[model samples]
Target: MTHAELVFVPILGRGHIVSMVEMAKLLVGRDPRLSVTVLIMKLPFDSDFDSYTSSLAASVDTARIRFVHLTCENTDAEISSASFLTNFIEGSKPHVKRAVAELVDSAGSTRRLAGFVLDAFCSTLIDLANEFGVPSYVFFTSSAAFLGLMLHLQSLQDEHHVNIAEFKDSAGELDFPSFTNLLPTKILPSIVLTKESVRSFLEHAKRMRETKGIIVNTFDELEPHAVRSLAGLGAPAVYPVGPILSLDGETKKKADGSCGGDDIMEWLEKQPPSSVVFLCFGSRGSFGEEQVKEMACALERSGHRFLWSLRQPPPQKGQIEVPHDYADPTEVLPEGFLHRTAGLGKVIGWAPQTAILAHPAIGGFVSHCGWNSTLESIWFGMPVATWPLYAEQQFNAFQLVVELGLATEIKMDYRRDFRMESGVMTADVIEGGIRKLMEEAGGERRKKVKEASEKSRKALMEGGSSYLSLGRLIEDILNNMPLT
Candidate 1:
């Protein structure tokens, strides 16, 4: 048997890292002769490597799959001031250059460096792979439609129609014939929407052209137009392997060394099927005090069962607080809200999102529209109440709610590139959408969304478009790529 070694480097973020891990697990399981290494970022707050290292060890033999830590203090004031973490994979070329060199040395001579798979924003990895004469795969870490929208951003700029300074201003729709005029700069990826951040986005686009192979975590049938559009871009090959969840298909979160055991599923199981709404606003999106209060009021008003993932408290001096009259659903939530809504709701700090979404009882998702969360919602065949929080979330929301007819957007316009700081979707709006999605009165909405859910399931099943893509990706791209 031929032996090969592959390295997976992910931009440091919860969602991106998780996706990389899933792909890694799938690859190792498919090819016994292949050895894999995962390079994980060492954040200051996380002083030990046990948590990440042990998870991989549990999945694969320690000898075949290993974890290496890249010790970088991401807290450098300059890096933080420049928002490097948010833009790390795209703009921080210098840092990535050094990091890659260090990794190459650590990898040693035993295995030839095989083709590399990295987050889409990690365009610098393309250069690193070229330097080593290795092929590279770029994971877009977003919807295929969103990737198509980003690829067209440069064209939008070249046309001189996107006014970066005034993108936040009420500019009437710009023409995008390729997109059915569905995407507006205001609704494009958040990176493209900001005047201050345009340079980083341009750099990212320029670097993306270097990818030899591209992977999007989406099925072909889900966004056929976007998939075809991506093919038109210079990418030699594009693969859609999605609903790329890392969790086992099982509904419970069994404790696997070093990872915490949370009982979110146990709580979810008690609820009636199609009776509860699961709400989560990814890791980075946050709501101010006012928005939080509004959501509490709306959730209360809707009189529907809910499980809300509260935002971590803001770092500002004046912290946001829940309404005085609101009931606390858990000790983790602020004071009174739990006691008031004990029978009707539960608020957890962070639930096993994928497991919860896959639960039999979850009827709908109230999401921040982060790409990973959006896909998981669809994977579980649940309809969505789209509430965009940051970056490309608004763009994802536009596709899911308007173009795909799978969800209802809480608002039409987001606060201009204030990014996630624009605040949460208004509570009254949230209440209305939730009511329409969760109750019997939501009949028409349910029927339409249920159709989308069916399509999503069909896309991933046997003989499904995504299943074929995964086969091709493994057999054609991953299996054939030369390993050093």
Candidate 2:
């Protein structure tokens, strides 16, 4: 009997892990001989998982997938600190090397590791694949446009115009032809400025450039310029297979609580198209109490119907209270605002985001600009209001707002130098942006968003760009390896 091909290891982060998991699902669905083992920090369950997470967990189990947790504690500090980001970049190769070594040691002679697929950030795993005599494929989750930006950044640093720990605004445009406008040095990934950051990026990019093949979560038609540029890199053959989630059916299991049953789909079904705004900050982004209250006020005042997913606030000594000015408006809001905008909004501690976005009632999204969120929104034919919080989000926002022509930038206090500490955007700015999106009839911003939504739908249909790419990816995988 032929053995199943197992894909082990993932870059630690919600967005990275989610995209990689979708790729594994694609491989398994294409052939009976394939199977996948996902090594994550934690599985999608506890003794009692929430409805959304539980549904995700059940979907994995139904697919006959294997789960392995490295049990590494992904601390908040580890995710946020520039020092930690640096360490992760520097240590990723060694970390993957050790993890794969452990996997090989634990597997008996009967179980073969087969081929390995890893994230672009996991550069060291390529060497491990070489040692194990398995083909290695690098998976880049961001759009091709961002990859082009990274390549350009490498060139700029090579010329010594920019250095680590020192990045002045480059008034001139970026030299890359694929770029639509002058690419400022400010929007580049943090790991490209300093010598240490540059070295880390170079190490990983070299591995990717030298690897045998690569897969990008993008469709060819959507980014032909950037895609052609990457294809010219000459080392790895780039395959664009994307809109993966749209190809996969929803596998939500029903949730039963003592009060009643809650169906996320039903909630979405009850809303109107382009009327319900869905808000979700990526998993790692957090805000102070002040920012949270301001966000709530903006949503309430925008006069738009909405669904917001918020994290549980950190514990304070007494009950946390909104400022009196906000509280006096409406109780459903801070203290009294719900009565004013009754039935216009619902702010849950958390919502099933994917389910909500895929709903017919959801016309637009307020997103943190995580790549996964960007892809999901496009797949659902929904427009976005880009509010990037951190990391690659700024780059993602640029792609959405400037390159893709699908979203508007939520003007925040982020400086030209990209510092976040000294600024806090006020409720007025937030309210103004939302008001334009929801109410300003015939506004240019609204018209652009609507057009993008229609285009995205056409892109995912039969023979459409995303659909054809998915077929090509499956064909490549299935034909390359025979079922036993």
Q: Pick the candidate with the highest lDDT.
A: 1
Q: Quote the positional error of residue 226 for candidate 1 in Å.
A: 1.0
Score every model by TM-score: 0.83, 0.77
In order, what is each prediction's RMSD in angstroms? 4.8, 5.9
| CA lDDT, every model vs. true structure | 0.66, 0.61
Q: What residue runs in model 2 are displaced by over 4 Å at the alpha carbon? A: 1-4, 42-57, 61-64, 71-79, 83-113, 158-165, 168-173, 190-198, 233-235, 246-273, 312-333, 412-419, 440-484
Q: For model 1, how does the per-residue alpha-carbon lDDT over 170-236 read when each residue is reduced to its tens digit? A: 4556544335444565675555656766656655555666666677888776777778876665445
- TM-score of model 1 relative to the true fold? 0.83
